[model samples]
Target: MRPSSDRQAPGGGPRDFAAAEWTKLRSLRSTWALLALGTVLTVLVSLLFCALIGPEFRRADSAQRRALDPVGLTFTGLQFGQVPLVILAVMAVGNEYGTGMIRTSLAAIPRRGALLTAKLAVLGATGAVWGLLTGAVALTAGSTVLGASVPLHTDAVRALAGAGAYTGLLAVLAAALTFMVRRSLTALGVLLPFLFVVSGALAATPQLRSLARLLPDRAGLRLTQVHQDAGDLSPAAGGGVLLLWAAVAATGSYVALRRQDC
Candidate 1:
């Protein structure tokens, strides 16, 4: 008889693992709820901003008008909306550990690499779809409210794609960080404050703003803008910077999963 250690997971391959991950994610009510809330907040707040800012925009001084990017305005909610997605992603991974299911998962697969990859792929795919939908709807709503047409220029298309990528990467980052932290609340507690407050505040200071742009949220959000700030990187470059962060986090996740006692 073959040794038990030599046995393969019942249906474990790229396709099966991906399918299993998708099923696990979709089966969770919290996942649906968080995504739904994220969509609503992203679209609704952007629409509201359109209404509130339209008149103010018209009355603003030339300098303020020059600084505005209508396309970017459509997705203003992302600054706030990303929180729920972060929490959802963290919870997804963290809950498995919190609930003592990681042991069963590791027992079932025995391949941490494959399991982590599956989880990330599913989370990324879901976030990308959600981001695309939110971007499209927010832009449409903003244009309608502001009485202007947002053209499908190259920059606009890039913004939409970048938004999707940002959403996907952010989720992946959350999941990775959760694995490294080994606790959902601890991960959430760290991520929520840093991404929301610290990063923004750091980016707002002229002296330190250049340094802050290197952060994932700051760099990632730059893709949504057609115009770059004085010291900002090109949209493509900014996206690349954000990608680097996610990649680093993912590497850490895999390493931690391997080294840590599950």
Candidate 2:
């Protein structure tokens, strides 16, 4: 049988490129390891958050209790879970550049845009599937722990689907940034702090709250909330903001890839 990479369209069509990219991604052990870690973290953190909610709700006043969001509680783990996914996205594209495999890839598939599109498509799909699985598991575990308090309603379903889309968009954004910087560590350095520290800090500051809401992480995560604050954007609008950020990053990455030599 011919080598798998040798099997492609006459000129390496999009489908062929996507197949090759999937093969490459699946061959890496790190991909499975990171995804597994992400799932575990998401579920564990969600369960922990759910466990606390009952006690907290009991202690709270009526107004505070009224403000509680069971659907949102199930996704509390995503704050930690998304870190591994960011690493996964960064490594996916960064590793190729790190080891000079990008040169070989570029040589085999001269159309940089086609190669990038295929890679992003595969990465985005993987992220989405993993995100959905993580969200489902977390929601199930959280519901079991929280009992009747956690409603399995339309909003819950939206939150579950939103969790998947949020993670997928985040992964694409990270990958595109990796492509632009051409270094995994550099991308991680900037992105990790921005997501974890800067975004949270900015969101907490009265002066910066509006600006913070526009951030990709801050805006995208709004999708997982069943209850929105008075000033918060609707889930659909928040998703749009994230999608715009990913698009901008992708465009910048493409420009960098096309202009720079491998």
Candidate 3:
């Protein structure tokens, strides 16, 4: 008889693993709920901001008018909306550990790297799709409220794509971090506060602004902005920074998973 450790379970190929992960993900009610919440919040907040833009633009001086970023304004809700996605990502990996399902998963897949890759692929795709949907709806709603046509120019398309990539990268980062910590609450406790409070505070402080801009959330969001402020990174550069962070976290998770017992 062949050794059990060397045996490949039925349906253990990469594509099969991805399909299994997708099935598990889609079966979770929380996944849809969080995605829906994120979409609603993004569009509503965008509409609210767009509604105020007219009055603000009227009150603005020449410089302020020039500084107004309609494209950026359309995505104003991302800060608030991204929280649910982050929670969703954390829960995706963390739940398995919490429920002691990781062992079963390990037994079925055996290859830790393939299992993690499958999960990340499903997560990345889901996040990207949700992000694109939210971005498109938010942009349309904001444009309607502002009495303007939705911009379908190159920059606009780039911003939309950026939003999708940003959300996907964030999901990957959150999932990798959760895998490393092995607990949903612990990951959320760190991620929520850092993304909302700490990163913002650091960005606001002149002394820490440079350092803050390098953080994953701050850097990633730059991609969704059509206008660049003084000292702000270009959209490509910002995306690269975010990608680097996600890559590092993922690598760390892979290493940690290998070192630890399920």
Candidate 4:
């Protein structure tokens, strides 16, 4: 009988979890499409809005332009940009569950908590890098179109950084929810209403005004605006709120993943 060689299987390894995630991310057509859409939407809308408002401001007297927060003008597209961010984040996590790949993933990475953590780390890093480039491009392009000087104040820079952080953190949050809920469509159902309709309504309600400012979407929005409303939280405070949500969501996902079987 011939001796069988034992080196390693063609597929299995200690790094399989990360490799699997990388494959899933790259192979999924939606991932690339969504990312492209997010980038284009953010940059284009900012340019368009700036183009519309810039000429009007230029036509106005110096006094009128002085009163405007030029810094805020550059990020006007942030409001719309967030929609695609949420979608990308949601699909990243939710798709795994939807396709029943999480089970296979968990089986391979039996240390389920670690697997989720790795996923969050990978997505967060990707988000931060892409977001920084996108924000910088949008800000620069929008400023040129608007004919306004870019604000370099500490608070302004911090707020711009916060915008990138918010995108990455939200991506992790979306992933976590998928682990806990195991239902992509349902998670989106919950996420959408909470982000859009409910948050907007809450922000408008005087009775719920305090809580509304602390909500994830509301808080994240505040960070991108240079002019703080009377009731608006500071950009730093908004960052904290977003971070809190990311932490909570991540913890919840880890707990569920570890305790439950794939």
Predicted candidate 3 versus true structure: per-residue lDDT over 1-262, tens digit per residue: 8666645655458999999999999998989999999998888888889898967765777677547767767888888899999999999999999999999999888889999999988898888999899999987777677655567878778888999999999999999999999999999999999999999899999999999999898899888887788989889999999999999999999999998788
lDDT of 4 by residue, 124-190 (tens): 7667666777777887888788887665676567657876887777777777777788777777888
In model 4, what is the error at residue 203, expressed in angstroms?
Answer: 2.2
RMSD of each: 2.9, 3.1, 2.9, 3.6
Model 2, 24-69: lDDT tens digits are 9899898999999999999999899889886776677767755777
Q: Which candidate has the top score in lDDT? A: 3
Count: clashes, candidate 2: 0
Q: Which lDDT value does model 2 have at 164? A: 90
Ranking by lDDT: 3, 2, 1, 4
- lDDT at 215, model 3: 89
Instruction: List the global CA lDDT of all models.
Output: 0.85, 0.88, 0.89, 0.75
TM for every model, in the order presented, reads 0.91, 0.92, 0.93, 0.84
- Candidate 3's error at 28, in angstroms? 1.1
Give the lowest summed-lDDT range of ten residues in model 4: 6-15
Off by over 4 Å in 3: 1-11, 58-66
| Candidate 3, residue 46: how far the Cα is off, in Å | 1.6
Clashes of 3: 0
Instruction: Tell me the tens digit of each residue's lDDT in model 1 across 24-88.
Output: 88998989999889989998888888888888777777677546777788888887788888888
Q: Ten-residue segment with the worst summed lDDT in candidate 2? A: 3-12
